[model samples]
Target: MKQTDEVDDLLTRAGARWRADQEAPPEPDLEYMLSGGRKHRRWVPALAAASVAVIAAGVIAVLPDPKTPTAPTAQAPSTTAATPDARTPQTIAQGNDDFLVKPGDKVQVSGKIIAVPGKTPVFCPPLAVPDIGYPPGKEPAPSCPDNFAVKLNGLDLGQIPGLSTIKGVLSGEATVTGTWRGGAIDVDVQTALKPLDHPAQTELECPVPPGGWKSQPSNISSTAVTKFLAAHAYQATGPIFRYPNGTSRGAPVVILIGLAHGDADAFRQAFEKVYRGNYCVVPTLLSQSDEQRVTNAIGDVMSGNPKLGIYSASGPGLYGGRALAQVTAYTPEVKAALTPAGLDLIRVIPQVRPVR
Candidate 1:
């Protein structure tokens, strides 16, 4: 009985201890959840790596394209380099350099003969040859036009039939080269002509007297007249002179004579006072009525034979009227191509300076 009682008491005490343990607070579950969170952390790093790759792909799509190099283009023949009548050549040089002349453009030429391989003749515009004097006459003042220049030279009227047309002068297969230009064109041109050397040592000069005026022209003093006389004049002769057009017969000089009736005697005195040589004091005729004579005189001057120069003793239109008259008489092209600027037309007037 005593042993049974002791066992019961021990059981009771153990039970009491179990009850105390149950009454205490429960243990925290945080460590278990924390362990699970730590296990899944590797997935976060994997997701970050995938995001970085996607961002890099997007950047590449927005970049600009790179540039590549391009090739150069190709080059046509020059009018200056070819023969006057020859078909212009097509070559590399033609393509590279720009030519001043093209088809359908008018041009003026001034140059010397070098080589000619073609058959066509080249024509030059009228060159300025000063010293062809005006016709005779007595006037109050000088008869020379205000803008007249001593450099005024004769033009290439055309060819002289018997003497030498361009074909004969340049000869067959001749070559001519010179500095040529168009008045309106800004570029300087180098030109070539075929059949180069026909007009051998031909000379051109102003007209002389006696055979000069066969018939007096009524319009001689009109401003529209181109032919006139100068009291004192300059002359151009040859060696270098060429006649693309042929020469006229009779007076070998192409005279631009000025006429002024009673002014003739006065011009004689002026000529004597200003010049003394083969220049003689000739009496002015009442009428200079010879057109053929004048033309022949000019033709003779252009002929390559004996070089000659003409003198004008008298001039009626002087001072104010002289320039206007001259502008009307000699400036055909200028009148035709009138511009407000008036830069193309050259004006000449005699100023009181020491005559040398």
Candidate 2:
């Protein structure tokens, strides 16, 4: 009839079969029952019959038949693989792997834009193929190392005021997307350039003084001499100082002369006329020169064996001067020669004033 009545009927039939299959416990003897065992023996047979009925009902309710339905099981969520972002920046060295991409492959890279000596903008250009000369009036092709050059198209490197010279070692940050031809990288659409706060220092270890002065006169001019002294006069805040000559106190003065383009004779005459007396002059070389002469002069001074040396100064005008001493870059070659001669090569950087 109803589903509940049908279940009860099935359980009743199963329980009856289970009970028939089980062997009943033997009845206790009449004598044993009489000896106080009757109470414990009476409940044993009843409890056993009840347990069989309960087990049969549970089995019938839980067991599944061929046509019966079941609940679906839960499953875990799916996962995805991660990939590298193309927009992320990489170092110039890391991006220039030959095996990673083929020649003429387009890729993004970033690095410092360095300026090397030469009239052209490309720094560290590829070396010319020697023995095979170029055609007359035909310019050789410009080349660069894998990680070196960046195209100037759509990039404004000159906008940064800190970049003062195109001839010296200048450096700034840049990011560009370009095609890498065998020797040079040809930049295309996307690019960016940012100048650093301070321009890179020269390879030579020397101070670049500041404060602008009038150009030295072609001939020793009294007016030019006065102006030059006034421009470089000892300021309480300035590094250059007017010290008394060690040999003669107060009589002879030591002036740190920063010659622009005046000769030794012209500088001496101008100083004598301006101060109205003879003085010792110590000049600093601002440009590169013969490494051997510079090293010898510096070595003599450090060893307390000062020598007669000439310093060539160039600016708006050319000035050459014979000085008691001078300082310049002390390179590895200089150090090697001086060390064995028992000369201590002290690193001395000249003090310079800021350009006004």
TM-score of each: 0.15, 0.18
Summed over model 1, clashes come to: 74
Best by TM-score: 2
Error of 2 at 29 (Å): 93
Candidate 1 residues 1-356, lDDT tens each? 11112223223323322322232233222223322332111111211222321221111010111111101111111011111132122221132122223322333323322112232233322122233345553212212221221211122212222222232233111122222222122222333332211112111222445544331112222232212232121110000111122222211112222221334455456534432122222211111221112222222322321111111111111110000001111122332222221211112111101111
What is the lDDT, from 0 to 100, of the residue 61 in candidate 1?
11
Per-residue alpha-carbon lDDT of model 2 for 1-356, expressed as tens digits? 21123233343333332322223323122222223332211111211322322322111111111111111111211121111122221221121122133345664444345555452333231111233445764534434433324333333456433453433455554554556543334555334542112212211111222442211111112455546554433210001212132212122222234322224455556566554322334332221111123234444444442111111111100111111111122223333433332221112111110111
Deviation (Å) of 108 in candidate 2: 2.2
Task: For model 1, state the Cα shift of residue 169 in Å.
Answer: 32
Best-fitting candidate, scored by lDDT? 2
Model 2 lowest lDDT segment of ten: 309-318
- Whole-model lDDT, model 2: 0.28
